[model samples]
Target: MTGRGATTVWHEENIKRTFEWSAGAIFAIPLNVSCQHFNVSKDEPVRLLAGTNMPHLMNLFHNEDFIFRNPFRFHDRFSNDADYFRHNKRLTVRSWETNLIQDVNAFPLDDYPMKGKGVRIMRFGIAGTTYGCHIQEFPVGSRSTFHRHGPGAIVTVTQGTGFAMVWREGEERRRFEIRPGSIYSPGDLMYHGHFNTGHTTMRHFAMRGRSPKYSQDRYRTPLHDMIPFEEEPPEIHKEYLEELAENGITEAVSVVKE
Candidate 1:
């Protein structure tokens, strides 16, 4: 704790503290805990990314009080799947303090047709989680269809390279390259598409709400105006080239020749 806040540590018998984190460390914090993050380095900038399953709770109920109270206070008391007992469902808020992926390829992939493209996905293991996360892979030179949904999503690129094109209705398309450790988000209700420009398969881990009923009926594909790979807009092409050059990427493709 710093910057005008009290540096007080709670008296929890089992609490232990350590300050060792690497490049790809994933950590979690329990709900209603007092915690602080600090950057000890003075010359280098520290970037932090955060993810949570709070959306699942929001989708389950609308009461503001539920945020502070336990949602599953009596979860074990009932076996009924009724609406009233939804708050009684099993809920967990703890995760490995220093979780690391031993091997990305060890996980099995499940391929399915989504929005006209075959997508390979592998769900991560996080028991009692309400949010679903998986590693998604796109084969070389393939692209996903233009799709939109109400739930926002964040994808972190882990392997190969690609680019994501995002746009809203009546808005100009924005292109961004998907490099290793790169993160992209399709803002709520924004139509977005992804393309694997690299020669190898592109892999990214995606996080979003797991409940199908959450923001239901908001996912759509406006295929009528979907842009084809061969007919990609000239402005979008120009932006793609600019991003590649800015990021020191030498790989370039000719849309017309493809």
Candidate 2:
């Protein structure tokens, strides 16, 4: 072969290896990722992201349960590790004392410690499903401080309008307005945050599965933010640039600019 042809072959091989390496950690497909009870075919199209390689590829392969009434389905994760998400036993009738419920902010909870926290959750016997949703209303001109999810959550806007900035912690942030139907199913891990950007109180619905007090694990935490993702721990700054490229935005986010 010509030297130029050999070089081309070598470069192509390198590109292929990068493609495989970049995809991401291999997760053993869990048997029960579906939140629905229906069976799914293994032959269906599945998109497993190459790490943060394909941010647009939201859902992964193998098994899913369709939401009771919606076309969107939740994947069933049957791993022993996944099974231990604690939500049902989280709030017991007796657990409520002092006319309040514990661990729950009491927005609508009659007697929960998380009073005004979000909303009361009804139990779904099938595990790994988020039964309850909560909304934190942000008054006009107030932005939620940078924070990340303690456990994974799926969010939808119920009322009000605002902008949410999602990014790897400390990276360039991308802001999107939360409209009546704006929805996001983010990756299971990583430190991303939001901002409420509107003139009125912003209300949103979030579905968070039961997670152990320490499950998924968190590092540094402040008294106010009850989450695991920290901003000061140091992460890839390039994520911001990648986000900018991925989202097709050309302007820098002035999150810190006055």
Candidate 3:
């Protein structure tokens, strides 16, 4: 809501170096960050009840009742499982938002034209270690539904202020007065999300998983890309498209018709 359009603070300076910066000569910028919940899946009860009673339990986990994992939960070996990641069943990166289980950026804030004040993904790494560069802007009064990720992620506040919380069942587990420069994290299965907790608009960066530990195929599909970008992400903010194109990646994300 700064009339300054949007402000994006992502740097794709090769996912192989530290994102720390210097003022002019040499200065380590103290980046403020906090992790809320360290677990997003095992730490929470997923709706596994959807397929609990099938007599052929083996068949269920494979044919009828096996719960399909979202990109975040994709284990490295899934690619070998034909029933799930079979050659024909393999998943590719779909459009980030609408293509999958969640709504793509409903209120689009063009990361470019908006002065980067909107949502975005920042890529970073150092020598071989992992780091997060993804960022997001939550318009006032917005809220995401229940979901989980396989990555132990972090959320760093770069702009705006708001409230965020973690939960188990329908109860409010822990809450934070999300403010600019504050970081909160959701552990592996810490079933959680947030609203534009502040009366004004809210924005933050989500660090998706460890950097160097991520597998190569992880970036290829929404199933492994994590971050919940759906099957056919909407004709999104042009910045995202441009980023994919720059990475030598293509618009090959897939969709399964119901």
Candidates' lDDT values, in order?
0.52, 0.34, 0.35
Residues 1-258, candidate 1, lDDT per residue (tens digit)? 011111122213324333333344333333343346555554555565677866656888876696755444322322222221112221212111112233343334665344335456644433233354556677654556566666568888777887888888788877787787788888877878777777677777777655222322322323344455455456665655565566565544333232
TM-score to true structure, per model: 0.52, 0.35, 0.36
lDDT of 2: 0.34
TM-score between model 1 and native:
0.52
Model 1: CA > 4 A from native:
1-48, 53-106, 115-118, 211-258
lDDT of 2 by residue, 29-56 (tens): 1222322111132343333221121122
Model 1 Cα RMSD, 1 decimal: 9.8
Backbone clashes in each candidate structure, one number apiece? 1, 31, 41
Worst 10 residues of 1 by lDDT: 1-10
lDDT by residue for model 3 (1-258), tens: 111111112122312112221111111111211111111333333211011122434565665323332223223322222222111211122112110111112223333111122233323221122332333555443333334565456676555565565654455556567776566767666655554434455655455654322444444443222224242224332333354355453531211111
Candidate closer to the true structure by TM-score (higher is better), 2 or 3 = 3
